[model samples]
Target: MMLSSMTLSRKYVILGIAVAGLIGSLTSAGAQIQYQTGQNVAPVYEGWMHNDDGSIDMVFGYLNRNWEEVLSVPIGPENNVQPGGPDRGQPTIFVPRRFTQPPGERREQCVFRVRVPAGWGPKQEIAWTLTAHGRTDKAVGTLDPLDEIDTHVIAENRAFTITEGNKPPSIQSLKADPDTVTLPGTVTLTARVTDDGLPKPPAPQPGSGNAGGRGNAAAASSAVAALAFMGDASLDCR
Candidate 1:
């Protein structure tokens, strides 16, 4: 009986030690996984703005505590005004710029804008923020913030000048229509415009007029146009 009792005690002791070791191993593994995953586990935000002229603009940047402009690009402007050129009718606006973070820094700020529709009100302004982590491969101590905005309002009204043969007309809105009409008088007709924020089809000439560089700039414009008018189904900007 004495021997049996001693054997039972030893067995219990061995089981206890094994269980403790297993628990310790699991705890260590969890710590390692957490360490491997860098900071900031959040989703980035993106903003989309749509204009009545069948054009769309997209502005994207990071935000920390407040709104920051990271990058802004206007898409359909190039194709409508330029006459077979990428940016002929499009306004010559500054492209959104990016900033580089120095070592040990974990946050950044950026800002951008979209042209308001003809009758947008002050209350139409919309803003939002999001968080994301493990975006960078370097395993920085902190993560970055993603800002997003999607707003709709009346298009802005602007004056356009008509040259000798040019017509004085304006873009009202974009819709699906399949009809054609001929006017009685010899009036100049301005073509209706629609854009999805994608790059306009490549202009016939690369650098002839408003068409910018041949690479990403052209492609990005078209992309933005496509995203804007396509109804926010694919893009989360809205």
Candidate 2:
């Protein structure tokens, strides 16, 4: 009986050590540099209607690994639709602005907001998705993971499709009238930039549909505005 009790004691000691080690490993894993989605703008279709009589207000949100709210910011607003229309109700919140995790910090949640136009169709919402990019130092995760969380918002019957990936701004149009440059006088240069505007695009595969998708429309317009400025400058030089 004495020998059996001694063996039992020894076994319990070994078990305790194993359990403690396992717990330590789990703790370390939990701390292993996880990331939360940062808030950002969702893509908008060209010529699509928006709130505030075609204008939009975008807000963003951020979270930590334990699924806790971290930070939020307003990324700015865009007047995607024309100004004259019946009040499309109050502006909807789309793509709540948020912050990315700083190095060495864990993230919990990322939220986004967009103002939806009243009476917008379901298809319009279907094509829309909230695409967010992790900071350069962080890796992108799968859509399945993101869908599990309440990360996106659609107001007034507007829906959205969420995706993830990396993206850089693309120059949609660039022109220098009189393509050649001469040494003597200044030549106006026109540049148009189109970007998904995300640090990255979701599912960045080859021939992806609308590399920038609906977001490209807004970017294209901005590029055009920039090009117009260049045109003015070029004529001024002449």
- Judging by TM-score against the true structure, name the best candidate: 2
- lDDT for every model? 0.33, 0.36
Candidate 2 lDDT over 143-214, as tens digits, reads: 222222222332211222344552434754367766787766666566555667543335433444665643
Per-residue accuracy of model 1 over 83-142 as CA lDDT, tens digit each: 133332222222122133333333322233334344444334332222233132111111
- lDDT of the structure predicted as candidate 2: 0.36
* TM-score between candidate 1 and the true structure: 0.21
Candidate 1: list runs displaced more than 4 Å: 34-238
